[model samples]
Target: MLYGAAYYHEYQPYERLEQDIDLMKEMNLTVVRLGESTWYSWEPEDGVFKLDWMDRVIDAMHAADIKVIFGTPTYAIPPWMAKKHPEVMAQHHSGTYVPYGYRQNMNHAHPAFRYYAERVIRKLISHYASHPAIIGYQIDNETSSGQLHNPDVFQKFLWYLKDKYKTVDNLNEVWGLTYWSHRINEWDELWKPDGNSTPGYDLDWRRFQSQLVTDLLDWEAQIVREYARPDQFITQCFVGAYSRPEANVFDISKSLDIVAINPYHVTQSGLELDPQNDTDTIGPEWMTSRQDHVGVSQIFLNGDWARGAKEQNFLITELNANSIGGSSTNYPGYEGQLRQAVYTFISKGANMVAYWHWHTLHYGFETYWGGVLGHSLEKGRIGREFEQIGAELIAHSDILTDLSTQADVGFLYHEDSKYALSYMPALSQPGTGNPDPLTYERVFDNFYRMYFNVNAQTAIVHPEQEFEKYPLLVVPALYAADDALLERLVAYAKNGGHLLLTFRSGYGDEFARARWAVAPGILRDAVGASYQEYSNLMKEVLVKGEGLDLPEGAAATAWADGLELESAEALATYQHPHFGQFPAIVTKVVGKGRVTYCGTLPNMPLGEALAAWTMNKAGIDPVIEGLPTTVRVTSTTATSGERLLFFTNWSWTPQTLPAIPGGGKDLLANVSISESDTLELGAWDVKIIVQAK
Candidate 1:
């Protein structure tokens, strides 16, 4: 793996450029990302450019044998550009222009923003394209963070709708605008989609926003291609893959040569746990482990989503280097935590790992967001841990690079479903006193986490993608889907695929309208299940797994479908006095395969049991059996048929397990391990076993 960090030499408080280079070399940082957030430094005045300082930094990095991924400084606009062209600033939904103090505050659709962004990007790529030290270019830093929501963007959105719907009447009818007297009589009558009650309009508006960001990135990438060498790639560090409002990651990734992401985890005390819950009384150590599990699950989810965006191994452009300091309380990562984080991404198909920064700026908004070195510029605990990680990565780069995840399970995710369900949640959990509505994305993440916790190698699969490669497919909260996808699922199941679908799948069409047919819409026949009545679970409903072994008090939450079986057999039934006979989970044989429908949100124990059951039905085996729940295992196979097993312990408590089958060499430890021996993992430890071809 390529080990590196984002570096800002211009922001260095002292004259330690050479010293820092030596430190980076000592730590085995092979690459340094530069010039991303320095638009003002690059062009101090309008139409004037300065490149001397950046050149010096690049030369110094090259001298240390470190390559570079140069970034286009378009994410942050220069003060001069903002002052000269106030129209470039994005207007908020409240009809106010954003202030120029922050990065990503400009409207990408504005002509002024586009002109200057293109000029700066072209200039930077032209100047550095031939540099031997330059390996690639990062196009903008986290695009679409501040999405444009002004009159200009609104007009463009209207045009986009016109192109999509062709006529105003069609747009109005499709969005069901007549319900709220929101029908647009003329094209000009359509207004910005603020406070829009129509689901179709609101969902399409988000899609348009995603398109805007994708178009902006495509424009810059095309310009870069004109100047960059064939070996030089272009990528953008995507943030908020699952929950971002402005852009869809899958759409944006289509325009890049390689996918990249900036993923961060909350530190201790940062887990979104209900404070009044009993989890707080578990004591600090256990509580810390619980929170770390949550954080690590998010990292793994994001890494898998990044890889799924392009179906290729991606780079970790920015990862947590230190405790993030903003409005939140930040906790320093415990020792061995950094190494665990790095391996978490690597095991999931991350080709490169880069820390957010080389050094924490002495004076900035993120000054307390520590880096490899602190304000003293001396190596700290995290830095020392990173050094060890870097050395190991260097030692095993060849084997790691060719490694690709071998997963037999896939989790289907769709951005359109996420967008549609945001306005109208598919399931509603009550009695929690939390008024916030549950999102489909969160529900999907919960299911994904269940499989992940059990060390099941899983991939995020889009509905449009070729999902047949995985024998087992788990789809959760697919609130909005098209007929094609519904038919595809049925075909997949009929062809010997084991399909597991949770509550709210196929409830609505792509237009966000309820299906005219039976509940579950087009999937009723495929799943052999239909539900006409369902209710939110104000309290947990106990469910008894009839044939499958499950823990006591296994229950369903959020929502439960009053399912009436057509041709399916009940696998689990409700234990409630009034609903005792109703099936909570059912399965149906379709031709050579089977489909399982879960009527409600299965709690963790039930979810894990269901995952195990489904995997067995699909004839998929775990990478390593009997490993601790805290230890995550993922296996990858190289082109030469060499297999690699990555075991990451996500907890603070050390875990011991029997050596995995076919154990050959522990690449990280450089020691041979046999299947008969035992393997021990320290707190937040990682172990890699590579079996010869």
Candidate 2:
């Protein structure tokens, strides 16, 4: 339940450290992160450390009763390091160096960069380890900026392959490199990744790159742990890892304590939900998919991803204080939107909430990136919003901090599928013929949105985690999976679990090679259906059949699997000229469980109808009946054995809810609520009820 923002005393244009601290103290700010983005300020010259400069700021934080989370400022490099060793600069996949003008452009895989990074990290942590106000250390700004393609990095990748496969023959066999005479007799004959077209090479190369990034962070955590007390934690802030191609957040979380993310999204209209407003302001860089992207759902989806990273409560390391992105995208939350976003994060599993910074930078790359205080350095709407929000959090700290979010339906987040799909996408952008590299995210988001619409509490589970406990498992874009993983999924179906799968699933093996057998290679029997051919749609196709209560416009888009029934029943089929011969959706009962397959990506209404049908068959009902589309509800089991339910209104119009099934205490009002009494949520509002066990 900690609340505050990142403080950059060094970046402040004037000497207002005392004033800023006073304002924060007055606003009930609980904690502030310090010193993560300033390497040049920490060490202006090579071997010359200005370590004492941060001491006064830490003292001020302690005096004001606000805690601190210190960060190792290694994400950015000083000018001297780049000048001293130009090789430390990261070389991109295009054989060009990432220029020194930007942050996180250094090739941490390079030994020279590691040497200086380690030195600065150790120096920064040891200098302030004994400070009473410091609670933890953020290892790096983002675990990785992007993958490095340096010559040395490439050589290490070759060694990584050798260590993994043990022989060149094994590498050629697994990757199916014999195609087009691309098979190599020796590891030395392998071509550079820039000129390579093999899917196996691309998949394995991405894995090697992820390993390098993980190793660097693990190295940083080990160094920080040397000085960190048992009470203090070590974490790294990831800015929507899905957006960062090189970052493997679930794998990276294994090295640290908590998973933290920057859940930035469009506010105002972007948060609005309606069929007409679906794709209005969805920036290409926003958190969710452009199709039916509701801002609150996008944020909660990210929180679920973070919670699943380690299957524990996560931290909101950074979120919007004002308009999040660059200048043109300036649109902060309206009225109660900011507070609604906070509760949404908590409804998932956030233990802490912190903004990017305490005050807006007057001059810098983030100058327009507003903060609690704007350019005037005075508290405004942003400050007032957090003021009430912070007070509410402090009052409910006991129950809020000790709860674990509940999950109704689970989704598999496979890194291999994400990476492989990025390299070879299955769908193309509408109206534009360009290949959509974010094909994995598009399909994944669409499915997630579907479950969210049905009020099925979402849980993002990794492949290594146990998810068979959930009643329904929806897997989207499972395009590249090995036989072992696919076999486990089939077994899940046989064990009385309801499994939902979508197009392009099981088409490629782990190495991204198309299965020599028919489509859905290892899963055809368990799935009770098989598809030999698939096509990307140039136009939408109407689907009509059982379980699909469609409107006039309910149609399938993007890609379609020409599913031929074996032992499965057709749940839905395409209404097209020749493609109608194959089913678009199929289902079959296996052993005691059932398998449902979706052969095409459906539009919003169609997708929702499909989800409603699957959940009906799976016997997974909505948490609450008669809930509004603009209102979202989630619950967490408090340590005290009480169930805490959060109700959020995502629109500008206030909404009334149906009477509670059982009476509960409204913690916000400090009053008891009766089962017969209904509650009203204001525009962009939130309400939490504590129901006794």
Q: Between which residue pairs do clashes occur in model 2?
A: none
Candidate 2 ranges with C-alpha deviation above 4 Å:
241-243, 275-279, 282-294
Q: Give the alpha carbon lDDT tens digit for every residue of 128-208 in model 1.
A: 999999999999878874556788888888789889999988888788888968887799987666666778887888788
Q: Where is model 2 poorest over a 10-residue stretch in terms of lDDT?
A: 283-292
Backbone clash count, each prediction separately: 0, 0
How does residue 50 of candidate 1 score in lDDT?
95
Error of 2 at 589 (Å): 1.1
Models, CA RMSD each: 3.1, 1.7
Q: What clash count does candidate 2 reach? A: 0
Q: State how far residue 85 of model 2 sits from its true place (Å).
A: 0.7
Score every model by TM-score: 0.95, 0.97
User: Least lDDT summed over 10 consecutive residues: which range in candidate 1?
Assistant: 274-283
- Could you say which candidate leads in TM-score? 2
Candidate 1 regions exceeding 4 Å error are: 145-147, 268-293, 428-438
